[model samples]
Target: MVDTTLEGLSAVGDTTTGFDHPGLLYHDRDDYLGGARAFARAAVAAGGPVLVAVPGSNLAALRDALSDLGDAVHYADMAVAGRNPGRIIPGVLLAFAAAHPGRRVSIIGEPVWPGRTAMEYPACGQHEALINAVFAGRDAAILCPYDAALLDQDRIDDVWRTHPWMIGADGRRPSPWFAGAFAAADRFNRPLPPVPSAAATLPYVVIAELSRVRAFTAGQARSAGLTVDQTEDLIVAVNELAENTIRHTPAGGTVSFWTEPGHLVCQVDDAGHLVNPLAGRIPPAVTSEGGRGLLLVNQLCDLVRIHTRPTGTTIRMHMTLTP
Candidate 1:
């Protein structure tokens, strides 16, 4: 049976079939601990696996609060493990859920936090919204917390649109602004800004040109102060994207490179369109022969954004340069 504490937060439909996801609006550290502790404790009492994936400071605090539970509760530092919001679903959430089959999983996931850059916020919002569709019909309750005091008003408002229910100091209630899963995903799928005029661009029309693509990527990444390992990873990621274009599309794509604040950005534009919304978000089965290119790219980069339509598709990847 689902814990009453989590179930009670449901103001709409039954949560038994479709998972329960609630946005916890917390103003301070005390408010965050209170709500998160209650939710986790109840799940532990129900004898289900619990995962607490939040930022570093919160992870430390939650670890102390649930110290008695020990290994009963699994903890991950979201700041590192979920640096790329695109990896949270496949690498963090689903991986934990799949570990213990036939059991309900409870998670405290805080993806959006203070200090998140403007470029990263959209991916975080879409990740929160897509959780509904990805975990549909699963036995899990994910409580996402938002720092109302730290995050801006716009982000707090997005919390409502992404989550169906919300928990506040008063109590739990339905979010009137909640937009359904797919609609919310589409809302965040805004087109990426054009590459800067100064960005270096190269076009590859054949698979044989892959070597040149890697060389070009390495030169640009190194020039932007990326470390040796960072340059190699960026090269691999760009190679995978360019190779995909040659293999899938009749016309190959163009690759561009530029630098942002502390990041080196690489973009690939092709005449092909990506139809699968969950393409890189889900891990491929062991028996699968292919489909690991984008997943590998997500793992290698600090941030990734994709814009796809009937006209064409553009994929942008960001790698952080060493200090």
Candidate 2:
């Protein structure tokens, strides 16, 4: 058994006093996934329940890989469940931690991509806040798997600094309070596949022009092997975003559709400046009316990015398309 001792614990990022873990921090996805699989084995062998909260996009693979784990695991779609930890990460952590009485619970996170950086959208700021909030005062370890392409390492380390018993990717064992969580770090140091690219673009663009955002998205959906119901969902998501460009802009905008490895992307670029940061998406509480368009966009797409400057706001919305 991997011993849990501060002397064995290695720190990666800056360390703080209040609430942080001291464990390994991995930059590679393969390493992270491998670590997760190893930790799961250890957790199950120890005879405790494993709670996994994954992004909607990652559900299929995660389930397939861990399916044999049986009833020992309970799964949830964190985004669909509206369990956003960034906004209220602390509360989310507390609630989950309380739900599992004595059994060790592992928190798994796979948030949206192109996350807000200090330079871009500040809204993505709470990654660590969510982790700290959930693990605060609790003994459970946390595993945060984010898209490194989108988030900066500086910001990630800033969040890692908060946990006292945490382990980064450097093979350190933090305080035992953070040991299980650190063990999570230790288990994740493996290999990953190369980043997958999108499919061809020529035929994809031709289809988008021939149809409205609705039809275009629908056609692509079918071609991408999506179910009829799934096609409808993708259509609704794309239509709203496409319509936003046509309706809210001065002249008009261009909508281009394409397919990546696991996502169907709809990009709308208009001549209008998005003076307001909160232009498109709205919260769910005000669902009495029809203003929750972008809000739906946020929930439906695996990733959503809006680049607005003096030029215009380029909305890149990605929907997961898988078999």
* TM-score quality measure for candidate 1: 0.93
- The digit string of per-residue lDDT tens for model 1 on 13-129 reads 132434999988888777787777777777777788889999988999999988988788999999999999999999999999999889999989999999788889888998998
Q: What are the clash counts of all predictions, listed in order?
A: 0, 31
lDDT of 2 by residue, 217-321 (tens): 677778777767767766777667556656666656656666666666666666667654333322445446656776666555555656566766666666667
* Cα lDDT listed for each candidate: 0.86, 0.51
Candidate 1 — which pairs collide?
none
* CA lDDT for candidate 2: 0.51
Alpha-carbon RMSD, each predicted model: 3.1, 11.0
